[model samples]
Target: MIYKYFKECKKLIVLITLLGMLIGMLFFITKDTPPTLVLKKKKINIEYGQTYYANFKGLVDTTGMSKKEICYLKKNVSITDNLQNEDQKSYPAVGKYKIFIKYNNKLSTIQIICKDTLAPVLAFPKNVDVIKESDLESIDFKSLIIATDLSPLKEIQIDTSQIDIHRIGEYQVKVFVEDIYKNRREKEFKVNVTENKQETTNSQNNQENNVNKIESENNKPNEDITISQSNEKNNVKDHLDNGHQQTKPPQMVYWYECYLCGLYVDSNVSLEDAKKKFDQTKCTDAIEFSGIEWRHSRFHYGINHS
Candidate 1:
């Protein structure tokens, strides 16, 4: 009975040993099979300051692996950028980087390209109103242009071929610019050209008529003041029934013109005083004119019978 019990125990021990050997052989054969890591793409591009999600879909079968092994493989994967100054989290510069992943003593490299994503903003000034054929000699586009960008501007191009200063109408002016990252922007504006000569002449004539009307009301036959619209000097003769010759003091007429203002003034007062009076009476708005013209004429007063 003791021999029978020992035989049974021996058979049980042999069976257990055979099972352990078979398991060991199976594990060794499976280990010889290489691990697989498949990716959707070998390279990827992302804009600067963009977020990346680690949704790696192609992880090999972790079925028979322990949780510790899977965690170790995932943790070994890292992404690094080639930019010099910025941190790894925020890729501030444009360059190429590598995404390296290590699993099962294998290294997989993926290309990651960083690029600029922001577009440039362009702004234009208020509409430009200029005289026809007068101030067209210079066009300062820099003053009217307002541009901003995250990167340096590559170029600014202006197209003014449609603007014809000689024509009395509104035209379009187009502008375009680009940034370092190939981002583009464009703007269009209007340039108005109108006839100002007719307006100025009519305004001058009206002012002259007003001055003449005022002088006519104040002047009398014996002591009259006459103003002529002639380019040359005129002599005023004073006649007396007594035939006695008496010379009257010379009368001074001063002319004032401001290019910005269409009003003209002629008076016998000093230049400073004349300007002050003109500013008070006509230039109530006190708007500044760009240019000025002044002239003075000396003549004697004439008596008119009419």
Candidate 2:
């Protein structure tokens, strides 16, 4: 009886060991193959202020299996679950970030590439200087010289102190410039100061000649010209009768022109102020019209008409 009992106990122990092994194997088979994650779009490039989302789909042979715990493979990436799909996950961000999925302690690795999306900004131009026709006469230049910066791209303003004002001509210049992206830009313009070369040259020469003439006039002797007494008295009476009377002494026909103005110093224009209507250029023709008769002749301008 003792020998038979020992033999039966050894058979029962062997059967229990085999059953334990089978149960362990079954547990491992279910746990080893986790659900697979399928990513729809893995790479994204976006701007700083933009919004986006990462989409995905997943599946498994969990025909009779149930998910124990769902977790994220990555901690930083934001994940949103959509109950509509069998396996659902989404990640979105304006900047670059990574994401992953986990089911039942098994995780799917994350491989994502995100790009930056921001544009550089340009600053308002300053230090403006006007470019006139005279500048073009010396060379070629445009309407203005303006200073610009992209200090908004602070690194690009490497030579901030070097910005300067320059003039080349009326219609062209090399502008010192910087763009929003720190790019250097130069612009040119075309503006005509004068249409005719002859007129420009003549006007320039006339200005120079006038300066020389003034200098020479200063060196010349002051004339001791004296009018005959009879001429003076008659001229004085003629102006007085024509209403040249004033708080001060009556005007004299020094060069046959109104003293206050360069108009004809005659009797008929007594009604006009005569003081304001005269140009100094016409004053130089004083000697020819010194006589009342010639001064009274209707004035005709231009060498062609003369």
Query: Which model scores highest in lDDT?
Result: 1
- CA deviation > 4 Å runs, candidate 1: 1-35, 48-72, 75-90, 117-119, 195-212, 215-306
Q: Write the per-residue lDDT of candidate 1 for residues 27-137, one digit (tens) a residue.
A: 999766544455556777766533333233332346665676556545654433343424433223578776666655667777777777666555554355445664454
- Compute each candidate's TM-score over C-alphas: 0.48, 0.26
Q: Rate the local accuracy (lDDT) of all candidates.
A: 0.53, 0.33
C-alpha RMSD values across all candidates: 26.9, 34.2
lDDT of 2 by residue, 187-235 (tens): 4332222222334455766687688874444443322122122232211
- The TM-score between candidate 1 and the true structure equals 0.48
Q: Which ten residues in a row have the lowest lDDT in candidate 2?
A: 297-306
> What local lDDT score does residue 55 receive in model 2, on the 0 to 100 scale?
34
Relative to the unseen true structure, what is the C-alpha lDDT of residue 255 in candidate 2, on a scale of 0 to 100?
20
